[model samples]
Target: MELIQNTPELSAYLAASDVIDHEHPLVRTVAATLRADASDAYTYAKAAFEFVRDTIPHSHDIGDPRVTWRASDVLEQGTGICYAKAHALVALLRAEGIPAGLCYQKFDVVHGLIAVRLPGEERWARQDPRGNKVDVDAQFRIDREQLAFLIRPEFNEVDWPVLFAEPHPAVLQCLQEAVDEPHLWQTLPTEL
Candidate 1:
């Protein structure tokens, strides 16, 4: 699928903000550590992707109730649903000067992930740092998508193609207002 940026400017994807807060000290520290292991932007992106994917546990998958929306909180508290995990991964990517954005898919509910444009690439690749289950496995790859969930078109599941520089308001508002994972599950968006 072709990825469309909400903003025409590439800088928008790299800029730090309240959600994708790459400029935060913690994010920078993590980026520096990941950078030490990487010789180039793509290598650093792979390391960062693996860092979030392997290190952080998806709150719902682990039966953790805590809700986190921001990138730093996902890193600090160590738990988040898909959207929060995407935020963290995006921040880490941006920290290394990669252009990253948010994207979504709908299954039983809205699933969040991120897309990254390597320094000179004309296209972006979608990645799921939502962690893995014995059943659902996701991987980082640019040539093809290895997202966590496959859409069941018969079930009316859809992939929202419009990529954003920030979280979708509906998803962000739900995450912000949710008190816990249980609360979040009850209120998670069904579509964009």
Candidate 2:
């Protein structure tokens, strides 16, 4: 499989050592596995996303900040906040040929999720652990009553804010800026 060039957000992420050396064996292992399995980028990306979503338990409470985490951290502890989990997925997807990025939403609290908006696709997909294949796209976001049609009971219980059809304006701006400044991850605020 050919390695697709990193999206601006992904490129910035890889330039940061803290993210690349995120303290978790699973993160490194997953990244390595994706790199090795170059045949099918989409399959590798989806599998990696599923691994993080299903294997790591979600924590409602915000924990200590002193604990710097990577994908490996969540994999080892079997739990993680949404941001870390999304970060891990991003690392793995980028290691492969897939183009992936992070999408931050204001959910009472700021939360981030992994997003893979494949080129030429109108909708973005989200990974649901309890769902059929564990990889679901936003195009499946149905009306309130229609939720049952798209998600399983286990996934329905979690509060998933509606995904925006278009990327947030601020996020788009940041991504544009990143194209010029590849190392912008270090200077930008973590909110987005």
Most TM-score-accurate candidate: 1
Q: Lowest-lDDT window of 10 residues in candidate 1?
A: 143-152
Off by over 4 Å in 1: none
The candidate maximizing lDDT is 1
lDDT tens digits by residue: candidate 1, 97-176? 89999999988888999999998888999999999989988998998998888888899988888889989999999999
Candidate 1: pairs in clash: none
| Alpha carbon lDDT at 29, candidate 2 | 74
Each prediction's total of clashing residue pairs, residues at least 3 apart in sequence or on different chains, is 0, 3
TM-score between candidate 2 and the true structure:
0.49
lDDT of 2 by residue, 1-192 (tens): 012223434344333234433334556676676557544555566567657666655543333222223555555666545555665666666555445555544423344564554445444454432222234322222121111124234533233444432333444344334422223233233343
Error of 1 at 88 (Å): 0.1
TM per candidate comes to: 0.98, 0.49
